[model samples]
Each structure stands twice: as C-alpha cells, then as structure tokens.
Target: MIIAAYNAQDTLVRAVNSALGQQVPVEVLIIDDASSDDTPRVAEGLTRLHDNVRLIVSAENGGPSVARNRGLAEAQGEWIAILDADDAFLPGRLQRMTGVARRHEADLVADNLLFFDWQAQAVAGRALRLADDHVQQVGAADFVGQCMTGRSPFDYGQLKPIFRRRFLHARGLRYPPHLRHGEDFAFVLDWLLAGARFMLMGEGLYLFTQRIGSISSDSSGQSRTILNLQAMRDHTLGLLARPRIRADRALAGLLSKRADAIRDQAIWNRAYPHLRARRPGALLMEMLRDRRSWPMLARHLVRRHRARMLAR
Candidate 1:
C-alpha cells in the first residue's frame, strides 16, 4: 500500500498504522509532499519500527497527485493500493482487496468506503454499496463509459482501490499532478476510458476523515470547484473527440453522459430551494453553447427523442 501525505503531521501515523496493522504482510510507502511540518521526522521514526514502511520525502511541495505519482513510480508491489494521509484502512483491507484481485483477475479493484467525523465518529456508514447485481465484467471501453457517464460511483473514496501496477504501466497511466480537486477523477476516469478491467470489491475498507481544515471539507472559493469541474469536463471532451475511442458506442455514450454530469454538478453546487433558483436547463444549454460540446449534446437529445418516440 502507498500512502501519500502533504504536511499531514497529525494524521500521518494513523494512516500508516492502518497499512501496518493489516492481517497480511504489506509494505506502506509514505510520500511526504515537501511538508514544512515535522512530517519528515515523523515518517523517519515510523520507518525505524516497521520494515514494511518506507518514506519518500519530496524536496519541494507538490500536490497530492504528484505525491501519488511519485509513489506509483517507486512502488514494487504488483498490486498498488493508495491510502491517503488523513484516511485509514480497515484491519483486513489489503487482504480482502488482494484476494478479490486474484480471484477475479481484475486490473483494478475498488471497495466501498465510509466517512468519519473529526472526532472519529462515523458520519456515514457502508457508503457506495454496489447493488447485488452491480458486479460486472464489462469490456474496457464499457468501463470508461460508465465512469464518465456517472453510471458508477467513482469518487475520492476510490483512493482505496487496488490497481495492477503492470497494467497501469502498460497503459502509461498516472494522475495529473497539476489540478487539485479533479485530479483523481481525471486519472480514474481516463483509466476506465482506456478500457481497464475495473472491479468493485463490494466491501468497505477505507475510513475518510472529514476534519474541518481538511481539503475535502474546505469549500473555499466558489471558483475553485468550478475550475476543478472544468478541468474534468475538458479532459473528458478531449477523450470523446478521439475517433478510435469514440467509435465504441459505449465510450461515446459515456462521454456524453459525463459532460451532462459535469454541467449538472455546476447547477447543484448552488443552494436553490426553488426551480427558478436552479439552472439545470441553462447549464445544459451552456454545455451545448460550446461548438465542441454541441455534437455530444445533440446526440443525447436524439437519444431522448428516440426513447420518447418508442414510448409513444
């Protein structure tokens, strides 16, 4: 398991412990993102005790995506699992995940995750429980489409997913180190789009802490989230524009749905108690306003019209 941290002094140990306490033997690589805090000293101490635990201290501060990319580059495990600094894993997280990976021969395996409050209280339990029939062996193209279209639940909690290092390397996959918010979405969505064998383990093995000062908890600038969403939108559209990737109907459908998902999210971030306050229609129109987006929006409208005709 690879754990990435950015000045996560208070929570780093707990995150590392999660991987060490696992029932099976595992190595925990901790990447401290040039933290100004005592994270370096803290990590060094932890390494002395647990041989499976190692530390990668960055010379300069980089974002979480870069930190994870660094760890991904150095990871020796065939199966790579990511544990964030503020998040902890269940006791048997790795054992269960590796077991599923082997059994299914999947390139990627993700389980459900739960969130905890700052005081270590459970805020939400058993989140992302895939339906009983949610297990799927979709083609590579199909998987990407589902991710882009919001047909599947892929969120920050996906940090817990175990990835096949060989497969990821083969596809030249790495997180985009620039963006903060949409980095994971960009990375995971692209992998799915590239047609990886993605499997959901249907177990909850991650504990996401929602502390007040945490990045996830911070809804800082209204524009910050917008930039993140825009990055995701642009990345998806670029992929959709590819002739080969779009030739697959599943991938095309996914691109269209993901665009709507992005536009829908823009409307939702605003608090609106009335229909007039919501801009879903306007957002859809704005998405279509872009000449690049018109084709995707048109295809969606066409599909809806066909479905309506069939109903009539």
Candidate 2:
C-alpha cells in the first residue's frame, strides 16, 4: 500500500495503522512530501517499529501525482493500492478486493467509499449507494461517460482502485506528474481507454474522511483544479484522435461528452471564479474557443434568470 503524505501529521498514524492491520501481508510505503509538520518524524517512528513500513521523504513538495509516481516506481508488490494519508482502508479490504479481482479476472477493482467527519468523529454515510447485487463489471465507455458528463465539477472520478502491477507496467500507465488535483481522473481515464477490465464492488471498504485540507475538498485550489481538468480534456482529445480509438464508436462518444463537459467547466469557471467574477473578456473568449460553449452558457443564463425570478 502506498500512502502519500503532506502535512498529514494529525491523522497519518491512523491511516498507516489501518493498512498495517489489514488481513493480507501488507508492505507500507509512506512518502512524506516535504511536510512541515511532524509527519517525517512520525513516519520514521513507524518504519522503526515495523519492518514492513518504509519511510521515504522528499526534499521539496511535489504534490500527490509526483509522490504517487515515486511510490509506484519503488513498489515491489504484485498489486498496487493507494491509501491517502488522511483516509483509511477498512478491515479485510485487501483480501476482499483481491478475491473479487481474481474471480472476475479484473485488472482493476474499486469499492464504494464511506465518508467520515473528522471534527465530529462520526460516520456520515456511503459516498455511493450501489445496488444490492454483489459486484458488477463496468464497461470502459459507460464508466468514462459517467465520469466525463456529470454535472459535478470533478464527478466521481477520484475513486481509488487497486490495480494489477503487470497491467500498469505493460501499458506504461503512471499518474501524470504535471497534475496535482485531477491526476486520479486522468489516470483512471487512461486505464479505461487502454481497455482495462474494471470491476466495482457494492461494498464500501474505504473510509474517506471529510477534511479541510484534502485535495478534493480544498476550495482555495479551484483554479488549479480547473486547469488540470482542461489538461485532462486535451489529453482525452488526443487519445480519441488516434485511429484505433476513433474506430470505437462508444469510446468516441464518451470522449465527445468529456469534451463538452470541459467546455462547460471553462465557462463556469470564468463566470464564477470563487463565486464572484467580473471577467467578461474571459467568458467571451471561452465561448469563442468552443462552439458548444455558446449554447451551454445560454442555458446557464436561463437557469440564473429563472432562479432570480423565483427569488423575487
């Protein structure tokens, strides 16, 4: 299991302990990304206490993508599991997911996540309420469509999946080191486009805590997030442009949806940067850059007008 840490001293121990206490033989690689907090010292102590735990510290903070890529390079395990320093895996997570993957011959497997509140010290609920069925194999086109066309800015693309090391190595799949916020989305998209056998279990085996500084919840990082998503769209276009990809009608449709979603995001960001903006030129440029954006922006304006009428 690879845990990326950056100023995560408060909850790092719990996260590492969860992985260490799993049912399977686990090797913990904790990469401290130049955290100013006591994360380095805490990680060192963990390494000394347990031989399975290895602590590697970066001299400079290079964000989660770089940290995860570093861990991937050093990993010796047959399967790679990603555990955020602020989150945790439930008991039997590794054993259960591995069994499911092997049974379905899946290259990647992910389960639902349960949200926990840090300050309240309570569990909120499951992030995704799946069907009563046991497990389901998700098609690449369907998964990509759900991720790309959703109204949510980032959609549900941040899911952490356990991947077969051989599959990753064969495809040369690694997190884009340039992306800091939307790297997971891009990574998963790559796997989908590469025709990975992806499985989703109905059970929620990962505990995702609602924390202020987490990458997903940080409001201050919205601009960077938007830019990363734009890059993701560009990458998607490049992939879809390939002859093999263009031959797949379903995949091509998914990619088009992704492009449309990114165009909408561009207009939304320009209109409401941190909830308020006075950038007409930026909005105009966005509309001009993408032909689809004109209709999307017009629809947005209609919604706003209706909302104002209701308020009055």
- Measured by lDDT, the strongest candidate is 2
lDDT of each: 0.66, 0.75
Native-vs-model 1 lDDT? 0.66
In candidate 1, residue 75 scores what lDDT?
91
Q: Which model scores highest in TM-score? A: 2
TM-scores for candidates 1 onward, in order = 0.73, 0.78
Encode model 2's per-residue lDDT on 1-312: one tens digit a residue.
Answer: 899898888788999999988999988999999988799999999999999999888999888889999899888888999998878888999999999999999999988877655654555556565853469887767677667532532255767899898999999999988777667877887887788999988788888765322222233211112245567677667778788678998888877877778767666655444333556776667656656556556655564454334323
Model 2 stretches astray by more than 4 angstroms = 149-154, 211-227, 266-312
Worst ten in a row by lDDT for model 2: 217-226
RMSD of 2: 6.1
lDDT of 2: 0.75
After superposition, candidate 1 runs with Cα above 4 Å error: 131-135, 138-159, 193-195, 211-227, 270-312
